[model samples]
Target: MSVARTLFRLTLLAGALSPGLAHAAGLDGSQLSLLWALPFAGLLLSIALFPIVAPEVWHHHFGKISLGWALAFLLPCALWLDPATAGGVVVHAMVDEYLPFIVLLFALYTISGGILITGNLHGSPVLNTGLLALGAACASLMGTTGAAMLLIRPLLRANDNRRHNVHVVVFFIFLVGNIGGGLTPIGDPPLFLGFLKGVSFAWTFSNMLLPVLTACLILLVVFYLLDSHYYRKEGVLPRDPTPDNARLGIQGVFNFALLAGVVGAVLMSGMWQPGLDLNVLGVKVGIQNLLRDGILLTLAGASLALTPTTLRDANEFNWGPIAEVGKLFAAIFITMAPAIAILRAGPQGDLAALVALVSSADGSPINPMYFWLTGSLSSFLDNAPTYLVFFNLASGDATQMMTEYSATLLAISAGAVFMGANSYIGNAPNFMIKAIAEQRGVPMPGFFGYMGWAWVFLFPLFVLLTLVFFR
Candidate 1:
């Protein structure tokens, strides 16, 4: 069925299921039972398991599956609560959160896809490490998705002649696709969502600079050592694919200006708020935010119009990744409404015990727990919403989070961004990078197999970070 038709049917079903419950101002999470979370749990399991067990079916029908789960929650919600309230929640999730989230990602994905890195360099340990470092550095400047898409092919080409090249891609996902994006709001969706919620654009840079540097440096050093060890074991360097005299260059350089425009637009939204706003179904949408989204869409369009089609073809740009993210996160935002509302209820809600996990016996916020919980869930669930859950759990007030509870906010931010390297599904870019590598014959690990690498390499580092910084 068409997406519009499906949505229309779901709305009609919700209206039919309404049981004449009085109009509620909003969800009363304190009165909600844990049973309301079953659909959310089901969605999570579908995401985690379906691809591995049924790849073809998943690729074809994942959107339908997502819509199914959303309806599972929505139908019951409309029956048990006010239909208007439930409809309002759906509108809020779409307008206030999901639309902007997907638009920013779509813009970055499109603009970055237009720029292709041409030529190849030898995959010597030093060269590989240097490339990874460059990608990591560019991640925050352009975005994890943008940097990963721009560099992954070149990196894969550089190492294509090697036998033991899986580790290189793994670390690329670790550094460039995840941790490196922690430094700015524009760097990752989670941080961008934080920006939309009123966190300063510079707050992530200011607070996460040290942790991001420390993590990237450690990962780079370890990657170099491992790559060097493998290089020596290979005994003979394979014949170079590109001409030895071939030089590295870039195509579609105009997209770089477009990327800068995207950054400028985001900054303008945050810094140039004009106090004019539009309320759509009780969710406030600021004029500046609308302007920012418009500029981003325009920049993406300009990239497509200005950049040569040959460049995009060389980059192998496709809409699949962005489409997948939109479908899954659409379900995520809708199904997760009760969960987020329950979390926002704090000590009075059904999730009080979960909330208490991040606090101390004396009622103080526990920074390490916040780091671990946020990071752990982010490792498996989508990090953007995981960050939002914790952000609301701690204190939703952005000013307070930036000031009085700065350390706690820091812990939350670090956990969400840094620990996303723990698994392929941790961040959107991780899976994209892995898929590109596999297509280029890099043979990345399977889901659980990848986690084995993370367990040995990243887990210990996170434990250290918790003790040294979060504690």
Candidate 2:
């Protein structure tokens, strides 16, 4: 093993043992400078080493490079820090506090439009837009992953006849799989962390509506125009509305019931807090007792019992999505812990100066703008940690000196979560969608290529959102 990889793994091992100890120790200017330099050096080293790691790992897992860069700098920080701080950060991240919301959102997503119980409205010009709208709405309910799996195959089939069809897949990823998930805690993981941190769950819904709607509306228009251009170029004649296939009938009302049961169990799990006191069996138990011994066991049972076979037909159920999401996000969940710790140490002078420039003297300008830009970057990084870093800075309690800042800290939180879907890597589902698409034999663009599409399509929508809401 090279020196860099050895150091990298050791850092992760230390972080797993103890988290965030380095930052709390108060590194001096020179030490902080060295810390700052590590990410860049690590990024370069990882890129250089990526090709040599393993042939199949490179071919099958190369998309993980974006995540690799995030952990490189983080692991080193953890290794060098105090054990207490590092342990706390690592434990807090690992506890899966957001798993209940993840389960609920996924349940709703798969059950709603994802189950495809109603079937696609045949021959409608609005088919694509309607699906996108449904997708966006579902995202806030089911999460991007759930909604993406439920709809992607049908959407791809809907456009299967078109010869020049790359844009449809690209836009599907941009909207349904990613940006749509930004509106609610259920929509994405990063926002769920915000909710757990004390941001009201309902506040995100109202705050992100305008931006979500604007992006959906614009993307719908662009999708129409692009789909039309491709439709024309291929000279693909439109088919008259086909007869409805009632054979693929709704056999899953019970599955829906089971799905709801699973959701309820998850929500109930959230109410119990670790280390709080409770009395049971003539013995006093902490909240952790209920959560670990009682709630988790119940959750496992509900999930197992709620497993419905109707999904086999209703959504053309396959394990591919489950496998894909599991593999990519598992890597993200494990590797990105260190990255979150380093950012938690707070910004350095250059970063602080950059943030000041981004935030206006009016305070309002910088907050929303930072919300969008940070959100855009968050898509490529593991968005949860990226969201935390920006959330800390934007809500850093330093707003006393600024002017014209009327929005609450919650709105900043909303903006970061809502806008995280601007690229493939912005959130976990985005990459999962890409991976599943490729696995199913759909040719897709490389990382930079996908971003090119986002730059053209999403950037304008973001600008419009800023004009309408943030301004």
Which candidate comes out best when scored by TM-score? Answer: 1
List per-prediction Cα lDDT, in the order shown. Answer: 0.82, 0.54
Q: Taking the tens digit of each residue's C-alpha lDDT, what string does model 2 give over 1-471?
A: 432243335345544452333233333332244354554445434433543465466555534553454455445645775544433333333333223323443443344332444443432336766777777777666667667766776666555445555676787777777768767766776666666555555666776676677777788888887777666676654652323563334544454554444434434434445556643222234564345334434543444355465554544555455444443343344444443444445444434554554455666446565666566546555666676666666654323212223253433554555455555546656656675566556777666567688788877776776677765
Clashes of each: 0, 16
**Candidate 1 all-Cα RMSD:** 3.5
Q: Per-residue CA lDDT of candidate 1, range 239-350, in tens?
A: 8777877667988888888888888887787678689987544567899999999999999899889888888787767776676776777787788778767766778999
Angstrom error at residue 441, model 1: 4.1
Which residue ranges in model 2 land beyond 4 Å of their true spot? 1-93, 96-125, 237-248, 261-321, 330-339, 347-350, 358-365, 396-411
- Relative to the true structure, candidate 2 reaches a TM of 0.70
Question: On a 0 to 1 TM-score scale, where does candidate 1 land against the true structure?
Answer: 0.88
